[model samples]
Target: MDLHEYSRYDAVGLRALIVAGEVTAAEVESAARRALDRVNPEVNGLASPVFETALGHAGAGPFGGVPFLLKDSGPMAEGVEFFAGSRSLRGVRARHDHDLTRRFRAAGLAVLGLTTAPELGLSYATEPARTGPTRNPWDLARGVGGSSGGAAALVAAGAVPMAHANDSAGSVRIPASCCGLVGLKPSRGRTPTGPDSGDPAFGALAEFALTRTVRDAAHLLDAVQGPGVGDKYTAPPPPRPYADELGIGPGRLRVAVTVRAWSGVAVDPEVAEVTLKTAELLAELGHDVTEASPALDWEDVVHGTEAAEAAIAAPFLTAPGRPDPARLEAVSRALLAEAAELSALDLVAMLDAQNRVSRVVGAFFTGYDLLVTPTLGELPPPHGTLSSGEEGHTLRGWLEKLFAHGPFTVVFNLAGQPALSLPLGHSVGGVPIGVQFAAPYGREDVLIRVAAQLEEAVPWRDRIPPCFASKP
Candidate 1:
């Protein structure tokens, strides 16, 4: 298969070709490797390439033979190096396959390698001191949003149809917004963090993947959505396969639109214009659209997130033979200090705040079926704009900077609701702009339905980036 032919297909499309004997899985995998080789140099998306292992893989299932990449910050796959974009965990490998990784393999996604991330998955920019930066394919000088930033960049550049991504405070959706891809942060517990952790980041993290199309997102959710053994909680199951949700009209539902972020970060005019236009389009599509926002104490959200992050960092930072300060990034060191200062009472306060915010947002959702907002407050910033390696950052101050760039996404992580970012619009400069659609808890079906509608309404599939893998 040629790079152009390979790049045009989504995961499902590729799987169909493999299933029909039109092309073998090996051929598809070869095309993916070629695509990766062609683009990874320009985008710097691959953190660890395991191409040899992928060649030996003969996956079987709905997506059998589909090329996939795992994020360096994991849903761990045994034997693959697991670095959460930090030097502290450098050279470490998972002893066991994370439940989600097993599920990906079972569903027939051939794991190619690991993608880049910000150190400890902290920043919205994927410029880790350990792996440099994963540049945005749309504009090489800008960043692909972080944590899942590498996954987003590869998928955007047509290296792979979809790849593993996780979100705690917008890691998945932020990068999706920046890269013109489909980033679905399933409801908390919709996918597992299991045997290693019942819940990561105090139930704030949601494990999933980034894809180019809404149907691909839906199909993947169908393949991987379920609780793992010993999970702390499980999301209510969808009534049917998530793939069935596609092509179904969402009906005339109540949709709330807000360009103003609760954190009071000023939305860029271009981003605000895209979001408002999306709302108008929803109205045009016959939905009841209204300007409404749930009341939130931005401090509570920020504090709770800080506490969760500190807790996540504690185990690593306090471990036997913990990484030296020189081995860790500045923000990570700051996090270690913050974790040391955190008391049990601080965690309790975080839970209290989480409960309060979830309750308020839950109530708001009782009235509105969906909420529309810009995925990020600003466009994808230039490299160095949000570096974790930069010195002298207090944990709070660093989070403030992070939230300012992505004020719209972390709230839903706090609320444990399902949210998705779709590349629905673009800037006049030709960079993609993402508009996020969030649903109430356990309502991914709603998100998929609406996202598919928008996918059809504002077609972004043909809008390839200049640094595309297929381009010569």
Candidate 2:
């Protein structure tokens, strides 16, 4: 198959060709490798290559022969290193498929490689001190947002149709917003985090993917959405397959829009402008759009995130023969220091606060079907702008800096709602800007329906970035 032709089809289209015997999985895998060769060097998106392993598992199943990338953070395949973007875990290999990874394999996604992430996924940029930055495909000097930044970069650059991504405080949506793709964070407990540990980071984290199309995201959720045996929780099952819901009308709905950052920061003017424009578009599409947001305690979000980070990082800090202090990033070290001081009582208090915020946000959703907001406080900022530099940063200071990178996103993580970031606008500087649509728990169906409608109303599929791999 011609490389250009190969890059044109999304996962479903490629799957159709494979099923009809028009293109073999091997040919598609070869095409993906070529795309990676052309784009990965410029993008710095991949952490490691597993092309041979992908080749070995290319054919059969529903999405047979489709090239895919798995983010380095989780959903790891056996024998593959699960580095989590740190030199500390460089030699730690997965002994078996993470339940999510097993489902991806069952769906016939050929996992071509692992993608880069911030060290310990503690930052919003994909610049791990060990792996360097994953450059934005649209602008080389700018960053690809993280920790799913590399996954977004690869998909944006046409290196693969879609790749694994997850969110804890908007890892998936942040990058998708930065790179012009579809990123959906399924509701808490929507996807498994088991056969390893339950409730990743106290249910603040959820796994999903970054895709170029809404249907691709929907199909993937279909493939991987379920509770593993002994799961601590499970999302309410969709009435039907998410893919089947794509073409369905969302019905006339009420959407509350906000350009103000819930964390009390002013939205970047360009981002705000685009958000209002999107609200207008939604109104035109027959939804009741109003400028409103829930009045929840933002402090609760900050404290909850701090506790979760501490709980998640404590294990790494206590691991034997951990990375030398010199190797760890400043923010990561600060987080470790803070986590070490946190007690069980402190965690309980934070959890109570988080649950209160959840209840508050959930109550607001009763008045509105969805909440619309800017996906990020600003366009993808310049590299190093949001980084808590290597010196003199305290844990509180570092957390503030990181939250500022995505002030609008983490609230939903706190609420455990299904949120999606859609590439709906561009800034004056021409960087892509995204608008987020968040729905109450177990309501991804509503989000997808609206996403599909907006996709048709303002199509972005042909808007390729400058560093794209498939450009003729």
Best by lDDT: 1
Cα lDDT of all candidates, in order? 0.90, 0.86
Give per-model TM-scores.
0.98, 0.97
Reference-based TM-score, model 2 = 0.97
Stretches of candidate 1 exceeding 4 Å from the true structure: 55-58
Model 2: per-residue lDDT, tens digit, 1-472? 8768977888988899888889888888888999999999999998986556572352567787799999888888888877788866658877888888888888889888999999888888898877788999988889989889999999999989999998888899999999999999999888888877776778888888999989899998998898887789789999999998888999999999998876787778888888899999999999999889999787888888876787668668777656566677788778888788888899999999889889999999999999999999888978888674477787667768877768988888888999999999987777899999999899999999999999999999888898887775
lDDT of 2: 0.86
What RMSD, rounded to one decimal, does every model reach? 1.2, 1.4
Error of 2 at 223 (Å): 0.6
Each candidate's number of clashing pairs is 1, 0
